[model samples]
Target: MGELIRLEAGVEHTSWNSSRTKMAAGMSDGSVHIYEPLKGTNSDYSCSNRWKAHEVAVAKLVWAPSEYGDVIACCSKDGTMSIWEEIEDAEKRDVWQLCARFADTKAPVLDLQFANCASGLKLVAAGADAHLRVYEATDVLELKHWQLQAEFANAADVREKLERVSCTDASVCWRPATDPIQQQVFVVGFQTDSPQHSIAKVWEFGEAHQRWHLVAELSSPEHDYGRINHVSWAPNIGRPYELIAVSSSNSLSIWSMDIPSGPGQRPAVKLLGYFTDHQPGEVVQAEWDMSGMTLASAGADGVVRLWQSNLKGRWEEKSRVVGS
Candidate 1:
């Protein structure tokens, strides 16, 4: 409803984290602004500690696991990521402590995410250069620190078919909010070519085999072209398994991984529910609660919406943050 914090050089992108104590805002001038939203009033939205986070436009912001506390990772147009933390000790005041910083490639980074799935949770990030990188984070001396992790090379065959595919990075998300589901599968969406359209892939990792295997592919059924903006897995409650939901340019679709049909045993994706507010033009962001029971959505219309289901197990608009 009001301005939380205005960047002196203007802002580029912003993300709300699962941890209510933190916020990551990217600036147009290649820096990231970090803040702790104060509870209680008109002045609360403001970020308490603001600083220069990058050398180029910070294109994406992602907060690490809450278990890690105060760690945020940011991607930049310059092909670098900065993971930082706020030092709240009396000696540091409001300054930030740099946990990690490095350049993986020269490709512009677009999005970042952490996987909560089984075989140990992993942190994943993608950039404009068509690189999907995964990191195996370790908790040392009770401090959670992320390393080079691992990098998934570009799909060479897929890149050759599309112009600049190697430079275009994809977005990542995991299926199932429950600890049970998270430990089983990892999902990611890519901006691919026509006919190929966009793709959502599910991967399963074997701890004993020390290998990550491809489980399923959620591709465009009718070759309809809509770039996936984000993907989420609804919390499995009262239900048997997890439900995957993906948001695109103009539509939102939900699929049930529990129900299998046909020979391939592919999951069924139903148009469970969707709403398009013409005024917004586009749906930009979305997320589920920690339990995956509730969903929140935001669009260009500047309205924040929450969706829940009725007794019939159908999704419905439950609440909204309007005109903010």
Candidate 2:
């Protein structure tokens, strides 16, 4: 275990560099801080630089792929998003320069993620408007210029009535690509009273149609988990099926989805486990370890729980850590 390192401003979100050498934290004061480990120390860290990145609290921060250099994206409470690149000034001091800004966002961006594809780097942002927008960098070297590749509603049957429902939050996760031929895929869910808008849906970019298509919906006729709080698509190792964790106000559900063997084929989804021991509406995040063998979930109660499958292949809580 690493030593405890605390921040004064309090961090709302954090993203580590691809190499894990540095971390970018979004503070409650609308500032972004970069921290790097001290030499010969695993736990000790030093804040290398920090700057005010937004006018309001930062809602989410995402680090671009290492191939894009030291670039990070941040969204704020004021319904805006921006991209930053780490650069050295004339004085040889490290600085974060604003490269791109979304000044005309229709609604608050709840979450954002970066994915690498065959064409180039793509970014997906989910908004309180119940829509997911996809953007692609025009030039790999130029972080300032990006083109809106696609924009579509995340849920079905609510495209024209967006004003009737209000979304509080949303979560998104990209499907880990295991093959070069795999197309772009992601899962997104919105926190809203509208039933359709609250369900998690899987989308895939269709190569032939040049648009995104709904591949699957993690829904069942027997149950409806209200207003998804988080969605995590587990990393695929050698498993024949894929695993996805979706959390709501009621329970945390683990699903096993079959991989499509051919193009335009929809995969089948089966509910593997549903656990509701955590405090309702307090579940914050769910993530999988590198091997995709163990699951870790955190809640607002300051408890971090680890879960795994038993010998019978049934998912169960293995351990937990209560934060001080």
Candidate 3:
């Protein structure tokens, strides 16, 4: 069973806060609608606020962890990303205010995500220029302030002399492991105009040098999957390493990474499985369950499919929920 709410016709994107108490929807008319679920009701939701978030259509929205309060980050087709915070005004009322705007892309920001790491909070944004930007805030209360930590391409090593490629779309997912001893890492998938550089890359932030480095390339020249649409890092509670699921035009691939024990060693990423029978059209998004044991994918054909691994560690199609 599912709940449905009538919203404006051109709802583009929506995201729920960490606590799942608030939901934000980005509309095609450059407005954002905030809604709170009505208590004691199963399918009722009320719109609490709405605002003009961007000059153009808002493409993506993500909320920070609850520790940071009710804060949201949005990317728009106007080539900018803005961070907003719901703060108490002088009259003891809550109001949404713009905290900061990031316009370094100068191109439409395709995808962005916030990572709540044990060290601190980090924000990652990918744009049409094929560049990935990372930002960090020194203080959680000071949402307006952020430092651009690193910027690089999605190649194996941006420092190396490689072919130039521009990204058409991008998605990022942070490693869910929060052990302070483990080095922080996140994965990025780039849908590039050029097939040679269309791949998923893993980037690691080094605490010693205070810089970012590319640790792994999950694609090869001969079999580079064309135009990755999304990448999700599954939460691992007992696994020694991490697992990542990637969705491209019509296929989904899963990979496992064996993180090395020392610096200067690259992570070994091995393909676990690939599934192509989920839907007949392009796969738009893929998400893992909280336990990282199950996966769900949505396709352009209006179908939501679920997948899980069996006792033999082989992935199988578990169920399918068709859309109306």
Best candidate, TM-score-wise? 2
Clashes of each: 13, 0, 0
Which candidate would rank higher by lDDT, 2 or 3?
A: 2
Give the candidate number with the greatest lDDT.
2
Candidate 3: tens digits of C-alpha lDDT, residues 113-230 = 9988876888999877777888888787688899888887665653432665666788988888557667778888878767645678888988888878889877644344667999
Residue 167, model 3: lDDT of 67
lDDT by residue (73-99, candidate 1, tens digit) is 788778777777766778767777776
Q: What's each prediction's TM-score?
A: 0.76, 0.93, 0.92
Candidate lDDT (C-alpha), each = 0.63, 0.87, 0.83
Clash pairs (backbone) in predicted model 3: none
lDDT of 3 at 236: 89
True-structure RMSD, every candidate = 4.5, 2.0, 2.1
Q: Which stretches of candidate 1 lie over 4 Å from their true place?
A: 1-9, 37-45, 88-94, 116-121, 138-149, 153-169, 180-184, 192-197, 220-225, 259-280, 289-294, 301-306, 316-324
Quote the positional error of residue 90 for candidate 3 in Å: 3.4
lDDT of 3 at 184: 78
Sliding window of 10 residues with minimal summed lDDT for model 3: 155-164
List ranges where model 3 is wrong by over 4 Å: 39-43, 157-162, 220-224
